[model samples]
Target: MLNTSRRLWNQFFRKARKVNNEPLNKVSLIVLIVVDIFILINVVMGLDDISRWYISPSQAEPCYSQWQNYRTKTTTDKDFEIIKNSFFGIDNPLSQEQIYQQVEERHLGKVSQTCFQYAKYQEQINIPPNQQIIQNIEQKQIQVSQFEQSNSNIRAQYDSTLLEKIAGQSREKSINVVGAEKAKQELDQNNQRISTLKQEITNLKNQLVTKPESMNFLGFLQEDSNFNQVEVNYQQASFWYPSIQLGFQSLFLVPLILVALSIHNFAQRREYGLIALISWHLLVIFFLPLILKIFEFLQVGVLFRFTFDILSTLLGGLLFLISYVYILLIPIVGFGIIQLCQKVILNTKAQAVRRIQDSRCIQCAKKIRTHDTYCPHCGYYQYIECPNCHNLTYKYLSHCHQCGAFQESSHNHA
Candidate 1:
């Protein structure tokens, strides 16, 4: 086993240092290395782009996230703040009732539209009639949005005018009467306009909500059967998204790896040294991204999630122990792989058979003369005594060349 490991190490070192009989000068080697880097970068970029072809969990069920949040939590001041920041674009205080109404109206319209789109995607509903209803609601919402924006501008202008009037009164100890009255009138007109716009916006939202078609769509979305199924689909999609990405990336890369490997092998056989070298580089470059993607999948894929959930359930407060568990587990898994390679893949007798057949030194894999009793390159014994035939035979071989008898103890000498 030790001799086998040494020979394998030497073989890998030679392969890594140079491709078959192809002498690459430093400059050309650097150029090839640069080409490899560029190809690897593009492959990774292509993989990332292909991974996005599938709809993400968030995109697949946007309505579910919003609905889940709405159902799970009571309306809080933070919710009001989010609405104020997003819609009003201001930090000015507003009555809680107004904020709550706006919040409810916004969520209802958003949830209805998202659910309708989702239903269409799922092919659960007729698209034409529902599309028309969605368009109508969208148009009304747009109008309301326009009105609210205008109202915000007017309100800002009124506040500025009011502040100016107050400043004038404070500085002079007496107001500029004409300017003050003009500002006052402007403020009142601004206030009235703001009120009118708010009322119009409210009416538009109310009409959208009360419209029979809109109400029916919302009702359908609210049904336990429809909503529950959507939730289930979303959860499943979320759970499987990483696996789907990994599978797609694998599909994209496997073909490239196979093609490169085939070309490399063919080139090597034909002694097309340059083609073999380039194909070898391509094969390595292709594998780079596949390895990285696999690591990423292991970190974020379904297996990780399943494992984490199990740990969370089983350990709870002791979950931090998982870090230690992984630290130990990885080395054990690595040791098992090493043992597999040593015992099965790089078995001493198996390697010796191939080396002997190739007329190469069993200890170093270098060419040897047929009549040589010992390897010239490594100065190792070339033959061993066969117990069955009592004749000289190649060392580390499972059979004796003289009698064609099995040499089960052949590896014991090595």
Candidate 2:
């Protein structure tokens, strides 16, 4: 059974992996983490062996023995005949196929009952179940089969296909009877509805021909005040309705924009192009994070959350496309894209340079790349003395790296 289950899982997983054509990523990682959590709960429920197919022979012995006893008793013994007909209700010896199925079900039940009994009232058994119990069960099962072989004159047999055909015909006749009754009822109901609707249709046709002559009927050409009220009610409901209720539910562009802008910003920052670096971060990192949080918060309810997720997934895709285009055009926002890159640099040295070495424009963090040394981000720069180590650095640096100290060094140095 374990082997069978493994084959099933392998077949399923192989198909999934083939369709993707690539290994899993962070999203898949996140999903698997969530799956693992549910699997842990299932493991606790003690259904693990159903998946693994590892039922012990000791557990199978009693079920196998009962199956053999019933198999032989059905052919020659009247008492066995009653038990077999009552349980399976088929006048046939138990087939190999039926035995296998019964064994599987019985073992599963035994495992579940055993686990439940152990948990419901604690008892400890240290040693493993021995082969003697399993062998005894197998011997009893063999005896019934041997007895049937020895008494072929009394033991009558019918092929499974013929037996199934007879059983199926009976079932089919019963189903046809039920279906006929249902169809007759439906036909009567539909006939009644058709008569009623025909009367209404005739009335409507007469009104269409005669109503235009009435002056009061001119109101039909104008707005119906009742319909206006319905329209207003619809508008009110639209705000709270799930995206399906709102026609353009597929086009949730906000989250898409954030994720796209973030990816773009990340790439631009890596390339050191300044525009996309800033734009990407401002839109995605700073904005997208805040947006997801707000969306999750607002959609705390299940129906609302599912609707929100669908809309958000759609919008997020479009936003990503836009972000990619923008990141190509403007490089600064690339700061936001760093999180996507497999390799992340702490860049303490570069960060130190950004903080202390280069002058940053007050309005932004753009580095002053040229000697004129005006702050590039905001174009705000001023020359300041390094009180410590006497090595001039950006005032924003706060601590002097030269002296390994917080304040500028008071002592003069070249």
Expressed as tens digits, the lDDT of each residue in 316-366 for candidate 2 is 756545445434533433435443331244332244355434433322334
- Candidate 1's residue-wise lDDT over 1-414, tens digit each? 576567667655444446543457898889888898899889988898778766666555555764565446554332322222222212436532344434445331222344555344323222344434444545655665665675555555656556766666463443333344555565566567656655664554455445464455445545566568668878888799899889989989999999998897577546566777788778878887887787677677886788778888989999888777667755675578679867795577786777777777776556788879888765789888988879999877768899999988787776
Which pairs clash (backbone N, Cα, C closer than 3 Å) in model 1?
A: none
Candidate number of the best TM-score: 1
Q: What stretches of model 1 exceed 4 Å from their correct place?
A: 1-13, 19-23, 49-185, 252-276, 341-349, 361-368, 371-414
Q: Model 2, poorest ten-residue lDDT window?
A: 119-128
Q: What is candidate 2's TM-score against the reference? A: 0.21
